[model samples]
Target: MTFFAEIFEGLRISWAAIRANRMRSVLTTLGVIIGVLTVTMMATAINGLNSTFQTSISIMGADVVYVQRFGWFMDRNEWLRSRNRREITMEQVRGVERQLTTAQAISPVAMTRKDLVYQRRNGGAVQIIGTTEKQVETGGLNMSQGRFFAAAEVEGARPVCVIGDDVATRMFPNESPLGRRLQVGDRTLEVVGVVEKRGRFLGMFSLDEVVFLPVTFFFNAYEQRPDLRIDVKVGSLAGIEETREELIGIMRKLRKTPPGAPDDFAINQQEAFVQNFNKVGGTIAALGLFVTGLSLFVGGIGIMNIMFVSVSERTKEIGIRRAIGAKRRTILLQFLIESVLLCVMGGIIALLLSAPITLVVALFLPAALSPSIILIALGVSITTGVISGFVPAYRASQMSPVDALRTE
Candidate 1:
């Protein structure tokens, strides 16, 4: 018979065997199903989170640069050791302003977590950012009502504030917050503006849970040290590279870094932080995938074991076929097709199970299920079937008709 004829014959026989032992065949394919489901679901969720963060970061403006004593989201050791280090003061902002004319705007920010109260309503804890008017534009904050503080207002330590949407819902539910007075600790400040809903980033902190006041007011009300950080925006988006370098040089000069010494201050860009997050997340995902793959590998071995047993149980039937002039290669192909069919069946079933779960996840959480994941699952199952089917088919083909009959 031709190769095509042999494959047709093998597929028919394989189908018969699967139908004869339906439960056994299903149980055998379950391993591949579980493995494919786990990896695909995780990949979908990670992809969604990655997309969400990228969008959020893009809204913060591409040309913006954050200057601080430490880098953004550094290791615990780096943070703990840098505790006693000097803070980035407003002077650094002025120094960069003086040295670099490439930047369009620059301002420092000081932050604190405090309980806020207005009339009878109060929020548990809120982020209070003491920033200049430049932060209104540079930080991607949009005012929903009233105007931001002016440069003069910041310098004069004006008691003006801008609140976020979450605080708006909590502190001023009924009335418009504009022109109302909200108490930040012991001092009261006039609400100049309310920010529009900025949504959540990093899957944790809501951007709308913040309130902005002038840094001068923060200093007077809290008696805090000058531990503020600066954000700089370049004149042209294309000039960010040159602008970053110019800012770094100015900071180095202001900090008086000696010749050949590395910069004490750190400049962190949005892309850099996103890259770091992806690296760490990718590593964890890879590790989990590896562990899950091992389970599937063990399952593949079980499939091979079952196929071997089936070949042994049908030794007499095989001998009869060989006696009737069936070629050894034909016999081999039959068993190979049977094994592949088993895995393919499992792959189909697994995919069916995974689709709804993926859809549900995408609905509840920010995630995307890729078509590649389904293709990969199919490929892995087919490959597993072929590989595990080989040895049993080889053993069956080696059996002799006279001996196969004698055993019975």
Candidate 2:
């Protein structure tokens, strides 16, 4: 017979065997079903997390660097040292901007959390950012209506502000926000622009629940010295490392650090955040895979045990087939095909179970099972079947025709 014909015949025989004991077939495949379900769910969650983080980081601007007093994550000793260092100032921002040859834009940022009110409407505990006109460039902000505060307005510390999309929807639900006055703390400021909807940051905090004002205006309204950071946007992604080194050198010179002294300020970037997130993500993925892999391993052992039982039960049938001139290779192929078909069925059932689970998870996170994951699950199941069934199939193939038929 042709190769295709042999495969077809094996599949037909395998299906007949499975149908002959439906309950047993289903019970035998339970291990594979559980295994595939665990693996697919884990992969879906990890992929979702990766997608969410990449989106969040992109919004923060990959080419932008934050020059701040402290790094995002640091050791206790480093934190203490950073705390003692002098706060970044607007003057230093200007100095860096003046000296930077590869920077596209630089802006100083100061932030506070304040309750925003518009007549009777109130936006509670909104993040208030104080920055200059160049913030639009450095932060990659896009306006939905009107425009960012002009350079003159920033220089004058004008009582003008740009609101985020959530702020606009909340404060000016019935009317256009442009030209309307809003109360930021005790100060009344005109809303000159409304930012486009820029979803959550880190999938935890809403980026749109914010207000941006001129840096000078913020310093004026809040009598206390506001905490400051400088944001620098580089000309190209390729030169980010170079620009970072230059920034460090400039900061050291500006801060008057003694030669060989450790730097006080932190030059933070999205890449640094990504690297840290990846380390944590990788660990989570590894742990998840290890646990789920155990499930698959257990399933393989179950398949192996079931195949052995199948071989024992089919010894008479094997002997009969051998006596009828069925080749040993054909007998091996038949059992192996039966094992593989069982696993493939289990994989399909697992995918059906996983779909609803993944949908429920997506309601909370960005989870979704992709096509590649489906294909991988199927492939894993098939491979597991082949490995688990090989010994049992070989044993069945080696049966002697006379010994197998004597009992029957």
Candidate 3:
């Protein structure tokens, strides 16, 4: 017979055998279902998290650079121990503005969490961001109701505020927030604008809970000197790297660092954040794969055990086939095909069940259930079926027709 003809015969026999033992077949397939579901669902959640991060950071513009006392993902304990580190000051921000010709816009930021009160209405702890008007525009924030504070308001330390969605919902649930007065740390500020609802960055971090005011206002009210972080927006994508290098050199000069002295400030780009996230995320993905592989390994073992039993129960039938000019390879292929079909069927069932769950998640965030992941899952299941069925297939194929038929 032709190679295709033998394959057809093997598939025919495999399907009939599986059908004859429907309950066993279903039980075997259940193992693969668990394995595939665990892996695919984990992948979906990871993909969603990555999507959220990219979207949130891209909103700040690719060319924008943030200069601060410390990098975002630097170990907190280590940063704190660096006591000799110079705090970035307002003077440094001004120096950057004057010295960095490549920079398009620069603004300082200071932030704290404080209780907000609008007359009798009260908002719980909210992020009080001390920033300039340019900070708003450079950060890509939009005003939903009013406008951001002016440069004059910032320099004068005026009590003008731009409230976020969370504050508006809590402090002025039923009224327009604009023109209202809100109190922050014993200082009453006129709510000049309500910012559009910028959704949460990660699943755990909320941006809409912020209130923006001048950094000078923050300095005046808190009476505590805080490290200032400068936010810079480059004019174009091509100028981003040049802008960063220029700003770093300017900061070094302003800080009066000698030729050999290390720069005291940190310059951060969005790609740095993406790289940090991916590093941590890659570790998590590795752990998830290890765990999912364990489950798949267990399923493969179960398939091997059941296939052994199946071969034992069908010994007489096998011997009769072998006596009727069936080759040993034919017997091996038949059993292997049966095992693979069982796993592939389970994979189909798993895909059907996971599709809906993936859709629901994608509704809230971008999640790719790509063809690659599907193909990987199928390949794993098929490999499991083949590897685990190997010994049983070999034993059955090696059986002598007279010895197999004499049993019982």
Candidate 4:
């Protein structure tokens, strides 16, 4: 017979054997079902988190660099040292901007959280960002209505503000927020523009619960020395690294760091944040896979044990087949096929069960079911079947026809 014909014959025989002991076959597959479900769910959740993180960081503008007082992902000692470092100020921001030839836009940002009231509708704990007119360029925000605060307004520290989409919807649901007065702290400001909707970051923090105003106005109203963050947008994507180097040199001069002295300020970019996030994500994936592997290992052992029992119970049948024209290879193929079929069946059922579970998880966290995950789950199941069935299949193939007939 041809190779394909042999495989078909083995499959037919295996299916008949499984059907003859339907309950046993079903029970044997339970282990694999549970294993695949655990693995698939874990993969789905990890993939979802990765997808959501990428989307969230994209909103921060890949080409923009933030000059801050403290670095992200610093060690305890480094954090303590950075905490005592001088705060980045607007004077330093201007010094860097003056020498930056490769930069497209530069904005100094300061932020505070306060309660905002507009006609009895109150929004508590709203982030109020104080920035210059260049903020729109540096931030990559698109206007939904009206216009961003003008250069004149920022220079004059005018009582004007641009609200985020969530602020607009919640605070001004009944009317267009444009040209409306909103009380921020003890001062009342006019709403100049509304930002387009940018969804939540990491499925937790609301990106839209924000208010943007002139940095001068913020300093005036709060009367406090707020730490400033300098945001610089590069003129071209290819020149980002060059601009970063240039900015570092300029900032070092502005901060009056001695030659060869370690720089106090941190130049943070979106890629740095992504690299840190990837490290975290990779650790989570590794830990999850380790736990899931134990479950799959247990399932594989169950399959191997069940396959050994199956070979013992069908010894007489094996002898009868050997007595006929059947070869040892054929007997081995039949048992192996049966074991693989059982695992594949279990994998299919797990996928069906995982779909709804993934959907429910998506409602609360980022959870995705991708095609690669399905393929991997099925492949793992098939591999487990082959490895677990090998010994049993070899034993069945090695049986002597005479000895098999003697067994009752």
Worst 10 residues of 2 by lDDT: 219-228
Q: lDDT by residue for model 4 over 101-187, one digit each (tens)?
A: 989999999999989999888777799999999998999889999899998998899999999999999999999999999999889
**Candidate 2 TM-score, true structure as reference:** 0.95
Q: Count clashing pairs, candidate 2.
A: 0
Better of 1 and 2 by TM-score: 2
Clash list (residue pairs), candidate 1: 48-367
Worst 10 residues of 1 by lDDT: 35-44
Model 3 scores a C-alpha lDDT of 0.84
Off by over 4 Å in 3: 1-13, 75-81, 235-238, 319-331, 348-376, 394-408
lDDT of 3 by residue, 359-391 (tens): 887776667687766887788778878988899
Instruction: Give the Cα error of residue 375 in candidate 4, in Å.
Output: 1.1
**Candidate 2: which pairs clash?**
none
- lDDT of candidate 4 vs native? 0.89
For each candidate, what is the lDDT? 0.82, 0.89, 0.84, 0.89
Pick by TM-score: 1 or 3, better one: 3
Report how far off residue 69 is in candidate 1 (Å). Answer: 1.4
Q: Give TM per candidate.
A: 0.80, 0.95, 0.83, 0.94
Q: Give the TM-score of candidate 1.
A: 0.80
lDDT of 4 at 105: 96
